[model samples]
Target: MREDLTEQLSPAQIIERAEMSKAFRDVFALAGGKRVLFWMLEQCAIYTDAYTGENNSTNYALGLQSAGRKLIAKLDEIDPQFYPELLLAMKEIREADKAAAKSLAEKLEPEDDADIA
Candidate 1:
């Protein structure tokens, strides 16, 4: 076990820990269909609730809670900045979406001028 979490660990630690998780076994049993998506969403909701204020329960979701912790635990071995790549892409896409929505909203003038006055 890596004693110092602040210190960057090697991939070996991640592989070792992942091998010990129920989620990994479930991953291997995957038929690569809808269950994978459902399992991921189930686990994600547990993990997400750990941070998000709404629906603030974690463990009530069953295998998902520990499954999420095990997954986050592996991330300690990876480079500190690696996870943000996906977040950056998501942010960029959201900004573009908002801009497009604003343009569309501006184009939709009021149907009745009398309602405005």
Candidate 2:
């Protein structure tokens, strides 16, 4: 129940995040993957928000959007129809994550709570 939104991540959390980022970069390194990344960046840009201190959404979104545009422009790419596929994949992942979180939360809840009520 940490109230601070800007609390620093644990080392393990940081490593997990870094690994995820590296995985994305590895995917982007593949042929035609830049287009997929550019599309993802464009979608993500709008969701950025104030993070305080070192991180600013305005700057991050601006940079992300700019990089996305540059990536797409670099190849003069054709329409890859990435949106539909990515959207579906994201939806599935989100649902799985939600279920996992719910299961974890239930496990962490006090065992005596129901008896108390």
Candidate 3:
């Protein structure tokens, strides 16, 4: 009979391992499990700061493009289906943020003199 190693870990321990482990490929493999995938999706869904009302999608994308490249690669190896879906979701958030920022900029722009005549 095989004993489950993860079963021996407390919730905090598991989270700590996930966040701090140097073996990210192994961690990503574990995270690719169905339940863990849902958890990761939930975390990735937070593309903005709720209290600050700040859009962080661009930052997230940059991180993924740079510092997170290894994580992305691991994700691709672990769960190929999720990689494109994650990119699509982030892209949607970024486009929405851009549109909102443009609308706000237009609103804040001074009216033309012709309009005041």
Best by TM-score: 2
| lDDT (Cα atoms) of all candidates against the true structure | 0.51, 0.57, 0.57
Evaluate model 3: give its TM-score: 0.38
- For model 3, residues 47-110, the per-residue Cα lDDT tens digits are 3333433458566654434534555556665457656765555565567879999999999999
lDDT of 1 by residue, 8-108 (tens): 65688766655655454454344442244335545566435454333534334544667654544443344343234323544555678799999999889
**In model 1, what is the error at residue 21, expressed in angstroms?**
20
**Which stretches of candidate 2 lie above 4 Å from their native place?**
1-63, 71-79, 113-117
Q: What lDDT score is found at residue 29 in candidate 3?
A: 46
Better of 1 and 3 by TM-score: 3
lDDT of 3: 0.57
Query: How high is each candidate's TM-score?
Result: 0.36, 0.42, 0.38
Query: What TM-score should be assigned to candidate 2?
Result: 0.42
| Sliding window of 10 residues with minimal summed lDDT for model 2 | 74-83
Worst 10 residues of 1 by lDDT: 78-87
Model 1 segments beyond 4 Å from truth?
A: 1-43, 51-57, 61-82, 111-117
